[model samples]
Target: MSASIVCSALGFRWPDGDSVFTDLNLLIGEGRTGLIGVNGSGKSTLLRLLAGELTPASGSISITGELGYLPQTITLDATRRIDDVLGITAQRQALAAIESGRGTEADFGVVGEDWDVEERTRATLDRLGLGHLDLDRTVGAVSGGESVLLALAALLVRRPPVLLLDEPTNNLDLRARRLVHRAVADWPGVLVVVSHDRELLDLVDRIADLREGEVRYYGGNFSDYEAAVAAEQETAHRLVRAAEQDLRRQQREMIEARTKLDRRQRYGQKMSEQKREPKIVMGNRKRAAEVSAGKHRNMHLEKLAEAKDRVKEAEEAVRVDEEIRIRLPHTEVPPGREVLRLSTVELRNGPVLDLDLRGPERIALVGANGSGKTTLLRTIAGTLAPVSGEVALKVPMRWLPQRLDVLDDRLSTIDNVAAAAPDASAQSIRAQLAKFLLRGRKAEQQAGTLSGGERFRASLATLLLAEPAPQLFLLDEPTNNLDLASVAQLTQALTAYAGALVVSSHDIPFLRCLGITRWLHLDTDLTEVDPM
Candidate 1:
């Protein structure tokens, strides 16, 4: 298929004057394209540019047809009806007026050719597994996943030839995610999605990796992309090794040349001391020898510089996947130790829950969106009071909410961690932060200035490194907006934590990676479920 979207010499910068993309060119053709990149690689920004939500500072964007965009964060007015959220309230009202025999020319014009708007809306909703939803229902009454589906349904109803989805599966449950995956798989026109969801990416026809302000396309899905990247990395490593060896060889040659030149100069000085030649002849020879030496030294220096440049270039091709290495010995919960208990707990606008967690049990909280997973976590963390119940914690606890709002944006990452571990010295905290991948000047950067991944690592460090170390950890949707590499790092970090973990998440693969001993599905009641 021909290119459906084209970006030529695109340039963009944040209001703070931090450049995101410069002279970037990209082409997206007809098919499902999964856009993958490390966090802060301008994936979301590029989507916004394509969707017309953001304008490039330079160059142009060309689209063959109308565009539909679903933003990462879906925010709708709580008071608005579903029809309003779908952008069809006016058309619905116009249809009602015509059916009531009070139709005006303007009302007819408002509806235009969409005489079957309600039918189309219902059909779209049904396709998204939202057939039960009434158009009159308020947006607040729906779950977060339903809200995302509603937004997608709206886009589907429009039938735009070009669709841009930014983390569409974020905060969505398994069932909801499958619905989205099906829709993406069935899309006929150009579809470009920026997502960290591997399953969603697997449904795409191709993968677009954005790195170092460049886009490289790979045929097939995410798995295919990974394989290709692995092969490329191996080659890059080999090149790096070869370049380093060349650099070392140049250094050794330069040293040998210098030594030989020194020996020749000493011999000439000895001959002159013995008065083997006339004074004028000796002076001319000395000047000639100095000029020759200078030429030889410059040549070696030039070769060394070239070798160093080659090494740098080769190393740049190798991908960086830094691991978070930290041990939480204090967070360990011994066997048979009671961690937490909830007795006859009734969550606000949610099902009653009863749970007795003991030892270092890792529990995976799985449930559909709006099933009160977040509410239960909050109640356990004592951030939200249950409508009626008793929550007992036998040990220190730390909660990492989905929003990751635990850190103070005004403070540096080091200071943020310091707030959590007040008794720990700054030097110690800085060292621990380095284990979380925040090293040196990075730990000193203000939290507000950090990227999404950096902010997450900082927040995680604060939680895990807190004083009076937490024995029970509650993480809610921790992998929602994380890049694939960040997810791996998080999994690695959690692997070292010996605390009892109660994590509520829709990411099945991530939960599996956590080695969860128990899987609980929250619905009308919490019940033990088979680990998928």
Candidate 2:
């Protein structure tokens, strides 16, 4: 494959003096590449650099083909027509004017070599599941999923040789995701996508893992990468064990050698004191013993040093990802105990819903974006009131909103958690914070300055440590922006949570992993169904 993009000795730093990349190098060839990494690991930054949206602080990037980028969040002018979004308004107007007997040489010039702009636009839109949409329809009339598809259609019309997509499947329903998958499958140009969606990743030709400003390429898909990493880790562990054994053996041998040399020296001193040999002979024997002992000690010391080096090398080869382990006994609920009840509960402009939650039942709420998922969660958390209904809670609750905007930006992580649990001692709070991997100075950093992952941890700590501890949790899109490793940490943290959970998410895989006892599809009405 030919290389479409190359980055050499790249360096990038933020205005706050935070360094993201230092002397980073990469070669992205012609293929559908999947870029994945922990949140805040520079995946999107790299794409931006490739698209010429940002300049590198040092080094250079070379591109052999035209580039297009689709950002994680797509914002379009709602009042504009679809043609405006597709970048074909000029040509469309020229053709229309010519047809209306307003023809001119300039109009013909405008439509010169390519006069099928509208046809191509319609074809691209139809292929992306927007065939029924009129080109003159306003952007506001389309759903979010439709808007995303339209954005992609615009890029496809440009027909750039390289396309970059960041979290393209976010907020998309299953059907929308399928449409995206088909578009990705059929794309013929070089594609670089940064996403956490497993299904989307499966469509890539290879996987590029960005960690700490470095890119590590792995052949095949996510599953293949996991297998390769696992195999490597297994071998590393074996090497570590063997190296440890070797170090112990060397230590034992050194001790025995020292003991033997000391014993021989004492025997020689005893013989000399008893006058068993002549003075000259005794002196010669002592000199010979010293020379031999020095050689032996030096050899042992060298062996010991080598063994230590081996141990260090072996240990350095192993990688262990850290995870948070928590214990929230207060969140546990007993069987047959009512956690929440709702009768004639209706959102302000959404559907009416009735529910009875008991014990630690895990309920999954599925719906498209703007289907009132967040509104319902807010109502359940008592942050929003229903139009005309009653909501009864038998236990305390906490809500993890999609934006993770629970913390005070000006407050440090420790202070945020402390504010939630004012009665708890500082030492107790520190101990709990340590489990989230925020210790000492990290815990003292302001929430506003933390990275995406760090801010999430701080917000979660605040929620989990709140006073009058919550027995029910309402999480709205908890997995939206989390990296895979952070997702794993979240699983570990939630494993210890024995509360009833009402989580609204588009990530079905994550929900299934949480052992959801019931699944509810919230649209015009909330109905129970088999999630699988």
**Index of the highest-lDDT prediction:** 1
RMSD of each: 3.4, 2.7
lDDT of 2 by residue, 259-297 (tens): 999999999999999999999999999999999999999
Where is model 1 poorest over a 10-residue stretch in terms of lDDT? 1-10
lDDT of 2 at 125: 82
lDDT string for model 1 (46-107, tens) is 99899888989998999998899999999888999999888899999999999999999999
For candidate 2, the per-residue lDDT at 95 reads 97
Report lDDT per candidate: 0.93, 0.88
Q: How many backbone clashes does candidate 1 have?
A: 0
- Predicted structure with the largest TM-score when compared to the true one: 2
